[model samples]
Target chain A: MTHTSSSGTVRKGGTAKRNGRGLTGLLLVSAPVALLGWLIIYPIFNAVARTLFTAGDEGLHFSLDTYQRFFTDGYALNNLWLTLWVTAVCAACLMAICLPLALYLRFAKSRVAAVVQGLALFPMFVPSVILAYALIRTIGPNGGVDLVLNAVGLPKINSPYLTPWGPVIGLVWDNIPLTTLMLVAGLGGVSDNAVEAARDAGARRFALLRYIILPQIGNAMLVVLSFTVLGIFSAFTLPYVLGPASPEMMGPFMQRTFSQLSDSRMAVTQAVITFAICACFGAFYVRSIAKNREARR
Target chain B: MTAHLSRRGLLRAAAASSITLAMPRIAFAADGFVNVYTGSDSNISDFWTNVILPGFHETHADAKVRVVDAGDGAGLRAIADRAMAALGTDNDPQVDLLEAFVPDETEGSIEAGLWVNFTEAGLAGLDMVNPAARQTDFDLPYRGSQVLLAYDATRVSAEEAPKTWDELTAWIHANPGQFIYNRPDKGGSGGNFVRRAIHEANGRDPRKFTLDNYSEAYAAETLPGAWDILKGLAPSLYEGGAYSSGNTQSIQLLSQGVVTMTPVWSDQVLQALSMGVLPETTGLVQLQDLALCGGFSRITVPTNARNLDVAMQLVTYVLSKEVQSKIITELGGFPGVSWDHVDPALRAKYADVIPATIPTFPAGDWDAAINDGWYRNVAPGIARS
Candidate 1:
């Protein structure tokens, strides 16, 4: 009877300890949740609420008016279209340039890979404004590029870097290194044994690349693509400094509207549209990752 | 099949997500000194901060002014809005005074109730200021500035340089891809260039710029001519369709021999010359009829000014000839008031840099064409090859 009573006491004590541990776990998670609510949740709520409700004089109301202006305004539409074209062109170009570099890094000797890898990332460390100024000095009209082009019997190059192309070059310069790094990490995950297996089966190199290698790194490509899209879409520094005053990009437009017009609502509206576009690209990324995981399984 | 189905399902699902980000406000709240928000250049800001402020403080020992370089007029408007909102009250008014460039921006500020009426406080002193400077009701006269042509001597001689709009266009046609200027909508000087070009083409009275007189219909009829002229010369621009979007870039282009000549602010050209950024051979000339002219800046005491008496004293000192001379001689801008009475030494030192006479708007009509988006309509013309 005493033994039974002692066992019951131990069981009750064990249950109490487990309950205490559960309470402590809840307390730990509460901190992050509170922080996120304060930092993330509060601002978004405020921005949306403020933009939606705020009204100004002279036919400027909080309703769909700002969005209306965005669609109808020739400047805004042209810029948006321009931004889309630039971002698309940049992504395709980055993929073309970075994929090869990433492949080479993956296949080359480790020492060579490390050196090239460091050089590739060198562009990333330089600020966009600094890089822009340097580019203008080098490739701008009468810049070094022109001098060299002339010396080589080539026609003197005009400052193509001044037009919309200037920002595009800077964006690519800043983004290619990062994309290359991400792609290298992705390509590295491809198993050598799998590559060898395909080779042993008499698969042509092209066929193996198209099938085995591509599928293995498909998720990584998606991730890199998404990052490139975001980088181009949200980039302000490069475009702000180097971009043509008539920047077609949403980033510069939003900045101009906020800074020049002092139109907060329109700035937020453009921000929303830009974020939406970037988010769609992000979704593609997430979907690719999920597909890769399923394929592996 | 199961994997494919799961993948398709995942793609079909749309989930919502939110992210929040905050940008830090720039420097705020200094002690002893009043925080001034101005759109003036760095050299002038330095002059105002170092010499003028201290000189003023000499009389009123307790008074100190801290100058915050708040960018251009449009940029200053944005700063004023942000600073005021962050302070959560206009009662304290984050900036004591705003020195702006564009009249429209100043008009916007007045509409926003950010400005105090100066018609009552300093009318007598302002009368002593040049008629050109006192004309703008929104601002006190700081100085009158204008765009001038700067040319590379190696590429183009003084005789080869176009003295007028028609001559310039002809010269550009004769020498294709040898001329450049900033995009009009982007740079202040570019706008001046376009406006000047239009006014010169029309040969119409420029002083009548109000919309009632300079109607949209009139703009539609005449602006196209200006656009056509600019577009005709566009092929002569560097890269055909690409032009530098700013004065610095245009000057840089001139330095590189990308273009033989470009339009720039007269003072900017002078400052660049002083800094040895441009070759000694570069020449500056004011265009005929002057398309753009700098206006006077004013210091108004906001109705809600914290230190009203102190603000008046500051304004009173800023308007004095001694302060104006310091502003002009050191800052490289013409004085808001006539420096006819300035000491011979001071005038002699500033003679080369300062214009003997600064131009002004004939009346309210000067910016009428711009109000109708005349500059912007013609801007793309200069961009087309």
Candidate 2:
């Protein structure tokens, strides 16, 4: 007890000074924070400013006409809603799929478990553009699935390509590796002894998961949900290739508006709106981190 | 995100330094050098490299010609913008020549003052050039292409194909799920298809709209009718109003037997056929009453080009009977000079696809507006179900 107390005392005060706790911490954080402000934050504010203010006959007049049009326009609204819907669906699906996979990877120590983890993480290596095209060839209409099915005497299948669900499938597939990684890292907190104790207390799979696993991994779940939302919301390539043409996702919509329509202001407005929504999703992760810090203190 | 950003930053820095390093190596030779800029595809570039360069080098042994392909006109646009910026200034524009782009005066605006006036310049081969193909004195029209209907002959007979816009609309209604066009913004075939539709709706007069006549009010009055025509045919498109995402996709759909007919560029379809990407049974036909839009690939010499004399000599050579025949035979395009000047065999071979007239479309503001408007109004008519 005396030895432990002395070691703890050494870690608390003397070590805290030697570690990057005060001026060193401030210096380290300031550089990145300042760079981020210059690169990211400044551009975001500038985009918002440009969208709201324009050069007209009156000279730098402020008008919400573009915003009004974006809000009122059915096409723009459809794109926004589609983006939102796809993000929500992708986030939910990621949680449902990844949570279980994470639990299995945590408990199952069999050699087969290593293979499963490798397969799940495979998408992390594949680029998103390649993944989209690979998905199209693998499951799209008149593609490999049809060829195999026809050989087996089955009816021609409806393809997900050029549909709203197309981006969702590609996104979920591309996202599995990261989501599973985060979730598995979260599952690390669920100690084997605790899980075993809960099970011996007559807690079945559901109860054990509900009480022990869920509580231990709440922060990880929050991180995954927030990240999935943020990642899927701003995704461009997959949706551009796989999604429908009309009610498309915001990423492609902004791009088409900027390059195709030759309207940079409109595109910037769409971008600002996209990031604004994503920033709200980011609040969840920030809050979870803060809560963990407070609990530690 | 940080890793991706840092890697991208490093790549951009490397690219900038490399481009700077290569900048000085561009031909600064006082004579016997001309850098030709082209926005054409690899096939056309290959023709320029293998056929045009070698032939020109044979005539002028000491001549050094470099053909640089600026993809999809972006590099051309940037060069033009740079030249325009350097106007009345001493900055070296560094560009020698542009192919497939024209520098001419817009009506009621300041004179372009960009290209050398070839008509007044009196090049040696001017007399042999076809009068009808010449767009303006600013441009030397060397080759031409048109948008035509590409159909699968396996399912569609030659007689069954429509020869006019109205007939085509009827054919689409009759053969539902067999016809599709790409999105107007994404592909030229779809853009030309929509262009012909606009012409058909507005009293069937291609002359009502001009390159200089576009205004907000004029478009407001003229575009609604066109939208109505496009929307009317929406339900009859492939997969119940589904539009292909691009020109290549539209052709891909036809090759996959998903659609029977699609609007395709003449040169692209010819190249694809030669490469055996498209089936042997694919047939092409141009509308008779009012053909879809096509343009002559005009070669322009910037008035301030470093190699103006050599460029003009090259132009005269390009306008020769020999090179014009190569334009038709080797390049799969129509000759700038009349069909009479080209080899009889090549002219006869292209009889079916030779356009009656190359109708032009307004490109500056009209293209973007038409594409955007289609997305807003006509695209919504496509039933997702």
Give lDDT: candidate 2, residue A80: 92
* Candidate 2: stretches off by over 4 Å: A1-35, A293-297, B1-130, B137-140, B298-331, B336-345
- The 10-residue segment of model 2 chain A with minimum total lDDT is A1-10
Docking class of 1: incorrect
List TM-scores for all candidates, in order.
0.78, 0.82
The C-alpha interface RMSD of every prediction is 10.5, 8.9
Model 2 clash pairs are: none
Tens digit of per-residue lDDT, candidate 1, span B259-315:
787888766777778788898999776655443444445454444455556766777
Whose lDDT is greatest here?
A: 2
**Residue B302's lDDT in candidate 1:** 48
Residue B383, candidate 1: alpha-carbon lDDT: 42
Best by DockQ: 2
lDDT string for model 1 (A101-170, tens) is 9888888887978889898899988988789889888877678888888898998765657577878888
Real contacts recovered, all predictions: 0.34, 0.32
